[model samples]
Target: MQPRKAATADVPELIRLRAVALESLGTNPGPADAPWRRIARHWFDERINRRDDCVCLVVGGGPGEPLLACGMAWITYHLPDSRRPDGRRGYLDGIVTDTPAHGRGHARRIVDELVGWLHGAGIHYIQLHTSEAGKPVYEAAGFVPGRYPGMDLITAPPGP
Candidate 1:
């Protein structure tokens, strides 16, 4: 499968693939509410079209075809550090492969492409949060446990 950078026209499919990824993680956003879909579509549309720091990649399928896998990366600038002298880091997310398309190395291909692109763009640090099922794949891809401890601050509950 050939992995390519996603374009604006692929927003809808990217959203669908994101939901599929969420489903695999037990957070499937089923078609129960139109508002959520609308919100997500709008968010994705804007991000896909207007964001220079965000990028989405997909493998397999083309126009009018279902994507076999999809992944995204958001570039962030952090304080300069020894490991990341330029401070540009890549945060990978929404990596998913269609159920029937598993075991075909689609996710790996997408990750590889993303890593190459980020390296070419001078991003040396990359990170991702993966599910148990995805740990092996990521480990095999040369991602070891991170050196720095991670923490999160929940500023608000998940409702709008």
Candidate 2:
């Protein structure tokens, strides 16, 4: 399936796919009006098309149809170091598809496209976080578990 580059108008569907991903990871994305949803919609609208720094891709969503699957990534930089040289890295943020679309290759197709885009951008170091069910797709695209596991520290959101 041909995945389309997500546009501002695709934000809602992208949000829907994010909720799907969160649920698949066994976490609630909260209500539709959750603050994070609002924050994400605004971010996607402004950031999706930048191409230089980020990308979001989706399958389906033609006319009135819902999105079949979606995936996103963003690039980040760290100061040049011996370990990473230029220190540019691509983070494959997330990939999620509607339940009915499972067993199809849509997710892997999106991953392949993202990887191609990253490689074309001269990013050799790519990383991703995926559930056990999604590992095969990423592995097929050449991602292996990192020697360093990831950790996150939740912090209070800043007041507006």
Candidate 3:
């Protein structure tokens, strides 16, 4: 049970773990050919690697081998009106856990480490959204459901 930061070279394994995460949600949107898969891979490669706020933790299968579990978090800090910038109320996003490692608390452990880091950095809040399957782990970690429902707005470019 090792927990460590994921490197850029780990992109392929991260993609595979993401496939497992999506399938666990039920419904195969088809193999990595799905548009969402491409988008996710791109996001992981471009966004996570470049952004200081993003972190991806991975667990290797053995001493030095294939990756088996992974978790990601994007830490955002909303600045207050007075502060110049960087003053933040941390928010964690895009978290995923590999399928075979699900019941072993790997996800919870990963999240625990992330939240600890945030708090240590003086972050006031650390929040993440979860699916029904992940609810138990979050709850066990003392996470309570948010009072208001969350929403998202999707946009698309003009079609050809």
Candidate 4:
């Protein structure tokens, strides 16, 4: 089935899918009742319902059921470069499917749609960090290892 753009109602299931993804990558998902989950609900509403720069898609499930897979990406801006004179970039936040739905081409379809959305928004440079288990799907979608290395700096302590 074709994936559809996620609505605010899908926010909770999307959070669950993200946690499942983190666990698959061997990262801790933390406690279920963590305060951050409450805040995340608001963030999802803002980003998915009120924003135009983001694209989030979900597949499977029904009117009252949990979702099977979801994917999200958003635009980013950087100092201008030759390839992207406008400096518009696409950051693929993540994609995930419930364990029962793995190996069914869900990730590929979601990635394809998310990429299409980004391209529709005039973004050609897309980037994402994939787990080893997820690398093949991304590669098949035309993603290649970039020449530039990824680095990050911690600007603040974790938690509120």
Candidate 5:
């Protein structure tokens, strides 16, 4: 299981995989409009290429074939004014594994590889939100509960 940075050429496949991820989350990405596709492509371009404070990785693929898993890390550097030194913290995002490849540890492998990379990049404190199904895998990777309770702000579309 090799993990590597996704390339521009991996966009279409990444989009497909993302669709699968959305399905797992119980929603479709949206209508198949050019604008939507363009938006998605732009997101992929940034995420896969680590543009704009993000680092994306793909696994199980290489010069020979298809990547079985993909993950992303959105990093925010601690400002000089902030108390924390070291200059790097990250949020884990998009740990999606192909259903057919489930039980093979594809997702875990990708995440482990990403964590190693993050550590190498001088980022040690990281956080993530996961579905119940995903919780066990993350736990197995040594993640523990945070001191603060998690919260979210839900916003609805305007103009009913």
Candidate 6:
């Protein structure tokens, strides 16, 4: 199936698919959490509609059909580096596929599309953190283990 750039109208489905992805990663809120749903929807809306630096892509059965997979990238600028003289990097986020749609190459296709788009946009560096199940897919797409180690400091925990 062909991957398409997501529209603002696709936010609801994208949010749902994101939950599926997060759940697979063991990081999602309980399914009945209304507040989290509202917050996620709002966040996605702003990113999809208001942000020029974000791009969301999806592959699926088409309009009125369930999306098979979805992926997103956030563009950021940094001081020029040897690999990226322009200092443009694409941070991949929220790449997920419907549970029932796994093993169909949907996630791979969307990632390929995103990488191509990033290249066309003159972005040379791309990065993402993937689950163990997802490691193979990203690896096959030409991503190597990063040279620099990554560390995170969580300043605060989420509320219940």
Candidate 6 pairs with clashing backbones: none
Is 3 or 5 the stronger prediction by TM-score? 5
Best model number under lDDT: 4
Looking at candidate 3, what is the lDDT of residue 107? Answer: 77
TM-scores for every candidate against the unseen true structure: 0.87, 0.90, 0.78, 0.93, 0.82, 0.88
Clashes of 3: 0
lDDT per residue for candidate 1 within 60-157, as digits (tens), equals: 66768988898888898889888878788998888899898999999888888888877777887899988988888889889988899889987877
Please name the candidate that would achieve the greatest TM-score relative to the true structure. Answer: 4
* lDDT order of candidates, top first: 4, 2, 6, 1, 5, 3
Candidate that beats the other on lDDT, 2 or 6, i.e. the better one: 2
lDDT measured at residue 12 in model 3 versus the true structure, 0 to 100: 73
Q: List candidate 3 stretches off by more than 4 Å.
A: 27-29, 33-39, 61-64, 77-87
- For residue 54, model 1's alpha carbon misses the true position, in angstroms, by 2.5
Q: Tell me the deviation in Å of residue 143 in model 5.
A: 0.5
The TM-score between candidate 6 and the true structure equals 0.88
Q: lDDT for each of the candidates?
A: 0.82, 0.87, 0.72, 0.89, 0.78, 0.85
Q: Which is better, 2 or 3, measured by TM-score?
A: 2
Per residue, candidate 2 scores C-alpha lDDT tens digits across 22-111 of 888899989998999999888788778555689889999988889999988778898988867898888897688899999889998999
Residue lDDT tens for model 3, 1-160: 8668888777777777777766777857586577876787778887556877767777775545677677766666565656325657566654566655567767778778777767776775667787887888778878898867989999998999
Which candidate, 4 or 6, would have the higher TM-score against the true structure?
Answer: 4
As a whole number from 0 to 100, the lDDT of residue 159 in candidate 1 is: 100
* Count of steric clashes across candidates, in order: 0, 0, 0, 0, 0, 0
- Model 1, residue pairs in steric clash: none
